[model samples]
Structure formats: C-alpha cells, structure tokens
Target: MRCEEIRELLVAHADGELDDVERERVDSHLANCPACRRERAAFESTGNLLSLLGPVPGAGRSISARVMATVRGEDPWCGHIRRELTAFVDGELTEAEARPVREHLATCAACAAESRALERTGDALRAWKLPSMRIGLARLFAPPRARGRLLRFAAALAAACLLLAVGIAFFVSESGTATPPPGLLRAMEMLDPATLEILDQDPGLLEIVRDLELLESVTDEEVALLTLNGSGG
Candidate 1:
C-alpha cells in the first residue's frame, strides 16, 4: 500500500479495526515509511486524549430515563433525580456527590416536590411511636453465629421447662395415690411421649438448663459486643 492509502487507514489501524490483510499491508507500509508511522502514532495519541474526556454529559441520565420509562412508565429525566432524592434527604451523600443533585432539584419542580415528599416521609417515620416488644426482633436477623447461639439458648430454656413439667408429674405420681393438682394433670397431658423420649436421649440438655442464667448473661454480653463492632465498622 502507498503512504496515502496507509495514512487513510491509520485511525482504523490504531483502533485494531482493520481486516488482517489490510492491517498487514498497513503495517508493511508503516515500517518502511517514517511519515506514515508518525501519522499512526498521532492517531493513537489523539484516541488516548479523547478517552480522557470521559463519556458525553447527560449520557448516563439519558439511559437512566429510558430504563425508568420502560420499567415505571414515567418520564425519563425524573428517574435520575428521583433515585438520588432519598440519599439527598437523608444527608447521606458528600457535597461533591450532592451538588449536581441539588442543582437538578432546583431547576426541576417535579424532582423538588419529590425531595420534599421524601423529607416529610422521613419526618413521619421519626415522629411515629412504635410499640415496644419484650423480645428483640432484631435478633431474628442477627449474624449466623449470634443466631445459632440464640437458638441454643432458646432450646435450653425449653428443655428446662419440659424437665420441670416432668418433675412435677413425678412428684404428683409419688404422692401416695392422692389426686393431682388441677393444672398439674393438664401439664402432664400436654407432655407428649415423643418429648419424653427426646429428654431421655439428651441428658446433656438438663446440664444446659441448670446453667441457663450464666448462658443468658454470656449471650447478652456477646450481643452487646457484636452491636458495638457493627457500629464501629
């Protein structure tokens, strides 16, 4: 290929878009011609500079709008600001991250109204009085180790209660054929044969129940430790 042909294909060569035969011809010409080689280098340098300029402005917002339009059947421009409104309201974003969002909200009435709505929702949540639960429901979602420990503690308590019921039944039976107390008979009836078998198989459970207070104290301390670690993280 001549220098003119090679120069015309330099951009394609720099981008690796030329066919193998065309690329080979260009390479052969470029190696022999200083001017063509310089042209190829310049094309590559220009490409690098263009890449540093980043994506076109509003390109991300345009794509986000299209996606929101498809998924939500709403206007596209609102999608970008709507997604960030919660973070803006919560003061979760740094100033650099929040500036464009703030500017958009200022100019876009719909987005500004949505931001106000989010603020109101947050205020309502903070003001609401939730009912207190004796049991911490948060424990249900604790890390696996914590959850396992809680399950074991619960099992020990349950086994202890079952063992107490069994002891009461024995006491009633041993009372020289006297009629059992009212609830004692009912409790004995509720103690199924399967449960009695489980207790019989796992005698270690009785030991756990005996140290239930210590186990409970240890669990509380560990839970407190875990809460501190999570907050620190």
Candidate 2:
C-alpha cells in the first residue's frame, strides 16, 4: 500500500480494528518506509495518551464541582450575607443578624457595592410620593341606562324561568300522568293569583306546548319562518 493509503489505516490499525490481511499489509509498508513508520508511531503515541486520559468514573462530578466553585465568585461567605443585605437595609434584622452582613460588606467590595445599591433603592422608595386616592362607593352604583338594561334582563330571565316551569308541567301531563306531579303542585303553589287565573283561562295553551328538547332543537330559520307565517295570518 502507498504511504498515503497506509497512513489512513494507521488510526484504525492502532485501535486494532484492521483485519489480519490489512494489518500485515500496513506492517510490511511500515517496516520498509521510515516515514510511514514515524506516522504509525505518532498514531500509537496519540492512542496511548488518549487511553491514559480516558474518562475516570466520577471525573465529571469533580469537574462540575470546580466549575461551580469558580462561578460562585471569590467569597463563599458572601452568599448568605448578600441574601440578608435586603433585610439589613430595611432595619428588619437584629444587631446580631446584621453584624455578619456589616462585617462582610466592610471586607468584600462586591457585597459592599450590593449593600450600597440596596440602601439607594430603599431611600428612593421612601422618598417617592403616591397620589392621594378618594374612597367613594357612588361609582359602584350602575348608570341609569345600565340599570334599565339590567332590570329588563332580570324580567326576561324571570319570564323564561316561569315558562320553563310551565313547560315541565305540560311535558309531565303529556306523558299520561292523571294527577300533576308533587313538583308541579309546588310550582303552582308558588305562582301568583293573576298567573293562576291566566293558566285557568287557557288550559289548552299548556297542551299545545312542545317538549323542551323539541323547542331547544328548533333553529333560528324555523323561528323566522314561524314568525313570518304568524304575521301573514
């Protein structure tokens, strides 16, 4: 094999990946060619170095510990003191609690700078003037137009509920109940004299009423057609 071809196989040869025939060819070339022998030697040295430096089981954890230690900054004591600096600035900490933070700030330039920033922030907040707010319940009352809409909505809702109750009674009767259900009796008792008189005058209205399921299944187009026919009549 040519030196170039032999060099290509050198890495695989060093790794013992080459078959016996390919290894013999490469070995014959290396024995005669000093340049190829040097190339093979370089590959072998690199493999040996890589084997020596191959991953130790917990080397990753050791490296991570070092990286974290570097990232946490120069002072290990600053972490706890930095947390309490806010409380220290607010005068919320006792002298015992504040002493360590004070001593830390005095020695550590980074912590001292943070403490100064906290003090400035506290001072700015204390100096800030908030606009006075007038407490009034009058705004909670609805406007006249809104009140009218609300009243109309409430009346329409009440009427819908009454119609639903009457519909349920009609549905029960249609199912061949000779006497009204106890639920219907209670509903009738709750009705005013005027409503009872209206129902008495037009008992057939209840009989003509469709089931709620049928009424709900009705489409807007069907309602429009019904309205048009009613107007024509």
Best by lDDT: 1
Off by over 4 Å in 1: 1-75, 135-233
lDDT of 2 by residue, 135-213 (tens): 1112212354533332222222233335545544454346633232456434432556455444444323322322212
Candidate 2 regions with alpha-carbon error over 4 angstroms:
1-8, 11-74, 132-233
Best by TM-score: 2
Q: Cα deviation in Å at residue 150, candidate 2?
A: 21
TM-score of each: 0.30, 0.34
What C-alpha lDDT values do all the predictions have? 0.59, 0.56
- Please report how far candidate 2 places residue 207 from its true position, in Å: 62
The C-alpha local distance difference test score for the whole of candidate 1 amounts to: 0.59
